[model samples]
Structures are given as structure tokens and as C-alpha cells.
Target: MASPIHQRLREDVLASVFAPDEPLTEAKLTERYGASRTPVREALQRLEQDGLVERRGKAVVVRTHSAEEIIDIYESRIILEQAAAAKAAVKATALDRQLLTGLLTQMQQLDPSDGRSLAETNRAFHAQLWRATHSPSLIGLLERLDQQVRRYTLTTLTYPGRWPVVLADYAELLAAIGDGDSARAGEVAARHMSDALDIRLKMYAEDPRTL
Candidate 1:
């Protein structure tokens, strides 16, 4: 069983993978995360089990998404996120509303060059909204889905001219939620995922190997 420290380290490592511009190694992980090889190895093994990384011979690298995988993930996300949005519209408290508003503002101010920051913020916002549903089972499923597509989620944010569209969709979704319009909120959330999936498809078409 992994200790709490090891679990924390595993999450930290995954966060770093979500941010990295290139593949990481154990030496790099040791240098960056200030851990010995044993815990780093343990943490990375956990991450691999979570589908957040993959081993390449002696090297362990952050996982990258394929076109087919991207499609599948987005299909799942569209279903879950739309349901979450609708639930949030019906159930979100004033505190949830305030928190989401603050996140949206922060997202708007984010530098486009900082893809990792944008992706993290995006994940937090969606996760927070999902949590409003107060469904542990649903939350657990979304968390797994988030892990499965972490690579593509980060990759799509790195694409040129993508952030603005994302921000706009978020704005609309937030508005629908704030107005307590469950149907509109759900529709917006589903459309948002669809648009992102379309962009991913185009990127794949352009260069299947790179994505």
C-alpha cells in the first residue's frame, strides 16, 4: 500500500506531467519533485496504473492521446459534463456560483502561452461544478475520465487560437448555470465538448502522429 506521502507525490507527478512540454524521466522527476528514486518509482507506477503515464523501456513518460482515444474521451465527457452542468444548475449554492465566477474571471486573465495553467484551471472549474451534484459515484467516474484524457485535455489547450473559444463557451455555460437554466446549461456544456472534439479531430487530420 502506498503511504499518504506517496499518494501526494503521485498526484504531484501527474500534475507535472499535465504541465510538461516534453517527456519526463526519473532523474528529472527526482530533481523537480525532490524525491528519492524509490518513492518516485512508486509514485510513477501508481500514475501508470491510473493511465496518466506510460513506460518506454527504462524511461517513463507522460502519456499522449491518440485520435481514437481523444474521440472516445470527449464522447464520455460530453455525457458526464452535460449531466453535471444540468445538476449544477439545479443544485449549485450561492457559494458554488461565486467560486465558479471567480474561476471564470481567472481563466479570462490567463496568459495564452501558459497552457498548463489554463488546463488546470479548466479542470478545477469543471470538477467544482461536478461536485455540486453531490454524487460520489458520479464524481468518481468523472475523476477517472479526467485522468484518462489528461493528455488530450492538456494538448488541446496548447493548440493555437483555442483558448478564446474555450473561454467563450465557458462564459455561456456559466451564464446558463447562473440563471438556473438547466436545459440551456446542459446544452452549452455538451456543445462545448463537441467543439473541442471537432478541434481535436482537425488536429489529428493535420498530423495523426503528432497528436
Candidate 2:
């Protein structure tokens, strides 16, 4: 099992619980996680390896992003999701469609006030879409990229009128895949990412914390 110390640190970093580029002194981390230097070092090492934090002299800093990095990340997601959706369209079986439909149902049940649950449902929905492709390499790459973009992507539900739009996109993407319309599936996927990027860029512009 992974160390609880590591897990907690990793989650906080990925979620941007600390302000971007905030220094995480070893002493502070030890005190925060209530651990000795040894375990804290190990946990910090893990987070560093995952690119969520970086070592600066003796202190660790949460990875920060600029607007350029945000754009770059979205561009990468746009390309990958297009491919994933197209493949899913060609490859998805009835079971895959059924499972994705069930996820859509869960999304409907999610309360708009609850950001975390809504984000998970959104993530789960995308994960299922990628799974239909049955490409382990693609899934692995996307999983990592998702983490890199998580702090931004998870905010898709924060804006008023956003959830319905997101659900509509998902519905369209799912329908395209269900009908084996690879071209339409890819187009819907690209459009969905583009729409999300619009919201993401807005969030980044409105708050430095989001960028």
C-alpha cells in the first residue's frame, strides 16, 4: 500500500490545495502530516516524481502553470480525446454503451452544489469513454494528462449553465459511439474539449489560482 503521508500530500498537490508555487518546507510538511523527516522525504519524493511538486533548494514548491501551459494542455487533450472517441465509436459494444448510459444517469443525480462529486462523475464518464477504445497506452497517457489538468478540468461544473452543456456533449458523444459513427464521435469529442477549454481559459483569467 502507498503511505498515507504520500497519499495526502499527492492529493493536496494535485488539487492545488496550496497556492501555486507555494513553498512546502520539509519542516512544514513534517508538522502537517505529523511525521518524521524520513517519511515526509519519501512522500515528497513521490510527488516530485509525479510532477505535482518540484524541489527548490531545501523546500518543495507546488507546480504552477501559466496561461501558455494551460493552452498547451488543452491542445493535447483535444488531440487525444478525438482519437479516443473515434476509436471508441468503432470498437464500443453494447455493454460499453450500457455502462456509459448508467454513468450519465449518475451524472444526472449529482447535485450542482457539490463540486467534488460532480467532478468525479465527469471524470468517470470520460474514463468509460476511453475504456471503450481498449487501448491501454492511450488510457495510461490520458490518466496522467488528466492529473496534470485536474485542477482545471474539475472546475467544469462550477459555472452556472455549464453542467447541462457538458451533459449534452456527453450525450451526443455517447450517441455517436453507440451508433458507430466514428466521424461524428470524433467531432463531438473535439467540440466538447474545445467548450471545456473556453470555460477553463475563462476561469484562469478570472482567478490566478485557477491558472
Candidate 3:
């Protein structure tokens, strides 16, 4: 059976409801999830291994990335994603294109008001891009970066005027990849990743606590 306690805690961290550096004692988490200590400890240990939490003095706290660290992450993400896009252009099969097309269609048809669904779809779309790379090492690195990047994710669509920009970014990037232009794919991917950083930074500027 799935560990509902673990899943709930994981979701809270990913959602940013659990603030960085916030203390998480076993008692607190156990109470929060309505579970016993054993499961709570296991969940926290898993989170620690995942780099989302760390065991501190007497308790575990949500891991916080400094602004510089986040910048470095974005820098790494740009490199990996750009390379993935280029490689994908050379390797993506007909079925991959069809899957990407389906994802794009889903995004287009997604309700503008549903931020959660938009976020999930966005994750799926990008994950699909990485899969097209056909490189296990690249995919693994990209997945790690993606997970870390998500820890700081703000709802882009929730920000005024961000939704359209994001939609345009993906559309252009997808087109470049579809055309099998490695250079163009790299360019588009770089631009898209930069745009994403800009959006996150803009939100962080407005509310320093968001990050």
C-alpha cells in the first residue's frame, strides 16, 4: 500500500505550504498526518535523502536554497535543458512528436483559471521533452534539476500576464524541436529557461518570502 502520510507531506513541501527552514519535529508531522512516529520518521528521512529537508540540531527543517544557489540551479537547468532539446531534435521519434502534440493540445485546452492543473500539465510537458532526449544520464540530471526547480515554483498563471508569456514560450520551443533544428532548439530552450527564471525572480522580488 502507498504511504499516504509520506505522500501528503511530500505534497505540502512541493506546494510550498511548508516554508523553508521551518522546523519539522516527528511529533508535529505525526500529528499533522494523523500517523504514528515510525511512518513520520520514515517520511522525513526520505525527504532528507531527496534534499528537500535536512536533519538539524534536534529536528528536521525544510531545506532552503540561497538566492545564489537558486541562480546556480537555473544556470545548470538552462545548460541541461538546452542540450536536451538539441539532442531531442535529433532523436525524437514520430510517437514522441505525437505525444508532445497531445500535451500541447492539453495545455491549450486547459482552463485558464486552474493553476494547479496548469502546473501539473507544465511539468508533464517538460518531462516529456527530457524523455525525448533518449539519454538516461541527461534525463536523470534533468529530473534532479526539475525537482529542485519545483521547490521554488510559484504559480505562473496566477501572476498577472504570466500565463500568456508561458504559453508562448512553450509553443515556440515545441515548434523549434518539431522542425529538427538543433541550433534553433537550443536557442529556444535557452530562451524558455531564461524566461522561466525571470518569472520566478519577478515574483520573488514582489514577495521575498515566496522563495
Candidate 4:
């Protein structure tokens, strides 16, 4: 298990509590997180290894991605997430299905204007899907990649007309999994990522802050 400081710092970084490219100096982090210098330094090192932070000249700051890098990440995610969904179709247990169904119901009932809630729910739903694959290596890789993506504060779910579309994609993916149709599940997963990439580009075009 990760040390408490490391985990807390990781969560804060992933949640954008620390903005991208913001300096993560040891003194400030130690004061903010109430940790000693050594632990804080170690936590920063771990976060760097996780790709959530990097040394920028003389300072360590939250990692930032360019448009080209973001696109590449999404493309890689499409392939890996496709494999994960396919594996989930074959391996997901009754409990996994139950959990996914509950999350889907919550998402369906959520108000469209609640972007924060929608983003949280969407993250949970995808995390559950990753767990459903029951592959430790795969889950680790997906979670790491997802952490990098989540460092960007804005979610594609908040884009106009995107929430309902995401719901539809989830419904199809769930149905395919329920039927144990791996191929269908994989296809749906790939298409979902592709659509997200397109929406992300549109969001960036409208507002660079979404990057």
C-alpha cells in the first residue's frame, strides 16, 4: 500500500486540487499536507514516477500535456480500454454487473447541469469497469493512464450534448457485457474513446483552459 502522504498527494494531484504546471515545492507541500520534509520529498518523488509531476528547470511542478500528447494518450487508451472491456465481458462477475448497474442508474438520474457530479460518477463507472477485468496488470496500467488524463480538470461529459451520448455508449457496453459478447464490448469501448477524443478537441478549440 502507498504511504498516507503519497496517496493523499496523488489524490490531490489527480483531482486538480493542484493545477497543472503549478510549482510543487517541498516546503509548501509539507506545510499544506502537514508532513515532515523527508516524507514530503519522498511523496514528490513517487508522484514524479507516476507521471503526475516533473522537474521543470529548477522546480518540480504538476505535469502538463500538449494537444499532440493528449491525442496520443487517448489513442493509447482506446486500445487498452478496448482490451479491458473485452476482458470484462468474459470475466465480470454478477457482483461486478450489479455495481455497474447501480452506477449507471445513478448517472441516468443525475441532472445534466451537474458537471462535477457527472464527472465523478463517470470516473467511478470507468474504474469499476477496469476492476471488472480482474487483471491486476491491466488494471494498474489503465489506472495510471487514467490518472494522467484526470490531471486535466475539464471532463468531456460536460461538453454540450455529450452526457446523454455517454449514457447511450455505456448502455450498449453494459448490454454487450451482459451477453458476454466480447467483440461487441470491445467495439463499443473503442468507439466511446474515439468520441471522447473528438469532444476533447472541440473543447480545447473553444477554450484552451480545457487542456
Give the whole-model CA lDDT for all candidates, comma-separated: 0.80, 0.86, 0.83, 0.91
* Best candidate (score: TM-score): 4
lDDT of 3 at 175: 83
Which 10 consecutive residues of model 4 have the lowest summed lDDT? 151-160
| lDDT digits (tens) for residues 1-211 of candidate 3 | 4488888998888777875678888888888889999999888888788777887888788888877788889999999989999998888988888898899888988887788888888889888998998899999998887777586674755678777777787778778878988889888888888877887788878887777
- Per-residue CA lDDT of candidate 4, range 64-153, in tens? 899999999999999999999999999999999999999999999999889889989998999999999999999999988888888673
After superposition on all CA atoms, what RMSD does each candidate show versus the true structure? 4.3, 2.1, 2.4, 1.5
Model 2: which residue pairs collide?
none
Backbone clash total for model 4 is 0
Query: What ranking of all candidate models by TM-score puts the best one first?
Result: 4, 2, 3, 1
Candidate 4's error at 121, in angstroms? 1.0
Write down the TM-score for model 1. Answer: 0.75
What lDDT, from 0 to 1, does candidate 1 have? 0.80
Deviation from native of the Cα of residue 45 in model 3, angstroms: 2.3
Native-referenced Cα lDDT, model 4: 0.91
What's the ranking of the predictions by lDDT, best on top?
4, 2, 3, 1
Off by over 4 Å in 3: 1-4, 17-21, 31-39
lDDT tens digits by residue: candidate 1, 71-129: 88889989998998898898888898889889989999988888789888989988888
Per-residue lDDT tens digits of candidate 2, residues 107-153? 98789878889998888989999999999998988887787767666
